[model samples]
Target: MGDIIRVRGLEKRYGEVRALDGLDLTVPEGTVLGLLGPNGAGKTTAVRVITTLLRPDAGTAEVAGIDVLADPMEVRRRIGLSGQYAAVDEHLTGRENLEMVGRLYGFPRARARARAGELLERFDLADAGDRPSKTYSGGMRRRLDLAGALVAAPPVLVLDEPTTGLDPRSRIQMWEVIRELVSGGTSLLLTTQYLEEADRLADEIVVIDAGRAIARGTADQLKRQTGGERVQLVLADVADRDRTRVLLGEVCRSDVRDGETERELAAPAEGAATLMEVLRRLEEEGIAVLDIGLRRPTLDDVFLTLTGHGAEAPGTARTEEPAR
Candidate 1:
């Protein structure tokens, strides 16, 4: 499949702040691209530019083979966008909000109403379809906003932090919906601070820092960069710590490191084979472990190692601001 969304040398500046500096990325048709970054990393800015919400200072963006700058209206017609915050009319019923979006896209009144009903059902808002969105919970509002973005069933969908404030159950529901969309051949560009969300939904990931593409790969490929996998254990007795360390040191790829708690220790391992080796040694030595597990590096590890901070770290927000 070809790229449905392509950007090159995209630059956007908020006065002295380069919100997107030489940023580049692509989303293959029928695939999801997760855009990850810490605060002030230009993720939202890049979304705004591609969605035609904001003009970039320089460079190019295209959606579905149409230049975003040269044919923005056509691009808009081919892509659906859900921004950081829920963009719903508080006074309007859930059905009305989606119907309004369809109407704005030029769907006839009857067709708009039908489309809205379909989306309400698909997003699990059918029962509350007639209630004003202001009465909805945070998760409901987010679902409503996402439903609105799909009223026209555009080929390319851009979701910016779609489940940012959702409860765990609600977040999982959204992931299911996104996965369904991709399965039906919809291309997606998702920007998120939730590592697990990206790990679950994105076919590939792009990590941006200070407005540039710093890392790009599949979840496992990225995780491998932060030291692959590790064998971790908690000793039943603190006295076994030194021996456990020595035993692990003999088989581990790297030196053992203290885990989060006093009795816990972790060491890099090749994979399941190393885990088995550690277990066999512990059994022979009579050292008991309260817990033992082998785990691959997570996106959190990749984020910290690459960006020098967590994904949700507090700092300058890179959201849109009045040019000063």
Candidate 2:
């Protein structure tokens, strides 16, 4: 497939901070690309540059074959954007909000109304379409915002953490909506803090850290880069903590012990053969084996290995309030 979005050597600076440093990206047409990273890792900055909301200090970006820096209007016409929070008029009804977007995009009054009706039904908000946006829940507002962005029916969609503050059910609903959009051949650039969301939606994943592209690949590929599977064991008795640790060390190459509660092992080879060897060693040493399995590394493991930090690391807020 052809590239829908291409960025090269992009650089952005905010005072003394280098928000983006020589970043490069290419998103193929008709696929969802997830931009994954921690806060201050340049994910938002990259989005702003690509969407033409902010200019880069250096380098170039192209959206749907149009230069984002030179032809921002053309780029805008080809793309739809849903920022972190729902950018909808609270006073307007959901239908009115979508109609307003269509009007702003230069549609006639009748055409705007027709388009609004179509979007309302598509987003499953036809019943709530007449209600003020303020009366809707977080999920409803988010769907409205997304519908507004699609008023122009742009080919490319940029969703910046669209499900950030939604409840589980709401989030799932939004995810389904996104799936439907992408299945209909709309190219998407999704920036998200939720690993599960990316794993479920993104065709490709890009992990950025400290303003640079540290990793990019499919979810399984990135997970495999973490080296090997994780082996977790639970001790039957708290008193067997130290003894078990020592005995397990003979089979486990690298191990982490937290009292008698849990012991984690990182095995170089993750297979049934290795698992059997470990079990035999434990049993031979008169150690009671509680449970064991070869579990694949999660995206969290990839994040920690690449950035030296996990998703829940202190001072690492995933989503920030939009700039007022």
Candidate 3:
């Protein structure tokens, strides 16, 4: 897919906080690009800049062949944004909320009503269409907000943590909705703290930190960067913990990771040779195994290796800014 969004040398600062520091990113047509990062990593700032909601102090952003800086109004016409908080009117009914957005997008009276009905059904809000939004559940409100963003059917969609506070089921529902959107050819730029969300949704992911692009690739490609295979073994008995750790540590170039309960451990192995060595040593040590396998690296490992931090828990609000 050809890139529909392009940014280069993007720089933005809030006083001493360099929200975006020489960052660059791209999103191809008909693909989802997950912007993954931790607290104060500037994902939100980048979204604001690309959507023309905030102007950057320096650098360039181009969307759908229109320069974001030079033709912000045109850029607005080509993109839609759904933010972390659901932007909806609690006083209005679900149908009314959608209609209001349609009217604002310049749809005529009759057409606006029709679009509202379509979207209500599309987002599974048809039954609650006439009820006040204040009575809507969290998931309902979020879906309504997303439906509002789609009122004008802009080509590119940018969602900033759309599932931030949702329950697991609600989050899955939102993911389904997003998948359907992208499958219909709407290119997406999703900013998220949920690595799993990014892993499942993004065709490619870019890990940002301290306003810089630290890593970018498919999930597997990034995971491979952390190291080779991982030899994970869970002992049947906790008594063999130290012996297992010592033996596994010798075969792996890295330190053995003992689980808190001491029944499991994992180590970075060089390859099959190391795995064979580990198995032989474990056998000699008479450590009974519940399970053993050589597994590929995960995104979590990638994050820890890259930034000295793991992915933040879901629903975390990242407001602390890195010192400039």
Candidate 4:
């Protein structure tokens, strides 16, 4: 399928900071493109540029064949955007919020009402449709905001960190909603710092750092670049850390690295054979581990290898321009 969203050499600067530097990305029709990056990595900047919320210093962006810079109004009409925060009015009921969006898009009153009702049902918000959004939970508000974006039923959907602050269950619910949209042929561009989110949702992944596209591929392709399985260890005692590292270094293909906790460590392994060897060696030394497993290289490994740092939290990077 042809690309429904295309960006070439897109650049945006904030004084001395370059939010987007010669970045290029595309989303195939009816496919999901996950713009994976740490906070302040220009993911949001690129989204703003593509969605026509902000002008780029230099570059070309198109949505549904319309030039973003040349005819932004036309471009806007063909795409829907759900930004980082739920952009719903607390005073309005969920149904009213969606209907307002429909009216803004120039739908007549009858059609707007009908569309709002349809979306409330689609997003599983019909039960809370008439409640003031301030009374809804965080997830409910988010679903309502996304429903508002779909009021026009645009062909392309842009979600900027859609599940950033959601609880696990809420995030999964949002994923289901997104999956259903894609199944019905909606093209998606999803920006997120969550590795699992990208691995689970994206058809293609783009890894960006400091406003540049560093890597682009499917999740498996990117994982392959890191190579081999990772043998993860959770030591029974923190005192065994050094000894565990020494043991891991002997059998692992690469140096053992500290995990999230002091008791945890990970190293690259050849495969199941390597895992078995490590197990035997550890057992022989009488070293104990709370957990041990061999798993394929994850997107986190790919990010660490490519960027030399883990994904930053949302809002840690100063990538946006001040209000104009």
**lDDT of all predictions, in order shown?**
0.86, 0.81, 0.84, 0.86
TM-score of 1: 0.83
How much is 228 displaced in model 2, in angstroms? 7.1
Q: What overall lDDT, based on C-alpha atoms, would model 1 receive against the true structure? A: 0.86
Off by over 4 Å in 4: 234-265, 269-281, 289-300, 313-324
- Tell me, by TM-score, which candidate is best: 4
Tens digit of per-residue lDDT, candidate 3, span 177-272: 999889998999998887778878999999988788889998667766766468888999888888887787778866776543468788887668
Which regions of candidate 1 fall more than 4 Å away from where they truly are? 232-244, 251-253, 257-265, 269-296, 307-324
TM-score of each: 0.83, 0.82, 0.81, 0.85
lDDT per residue as tens, model 4, 1-324: 789999999999999999999999989899999999878889999999999989999989999888999999999899898967438999999999999999999999999999999999989999999999999998888898899889999999999999999999999999988888888989999999877789889999999888888999988788777664789889998898898899898887567777777898888877788889999999999999999999775545665667555464432433432110
Clash list (residue pairs), candidate 2: none
Query: By lDDT, highest first, what's the ranking?
Result: 4, 1, 3, 2
The candidate 1 region of ten consecutive residues with least summed lDDT is: 315-324
**Candidate 1 lDDT tens digits, 146-245:** 8988988999999999888889988888889889878998889999876667889999999888799989998777776766678989999999999998
Worst 10 residues of 4 by lDDT: 315-324
Off by over 4 Å in 3: 227-242, 246-264, 268-300, 310-324
* Number of backbone clashes in candidate 4: 0
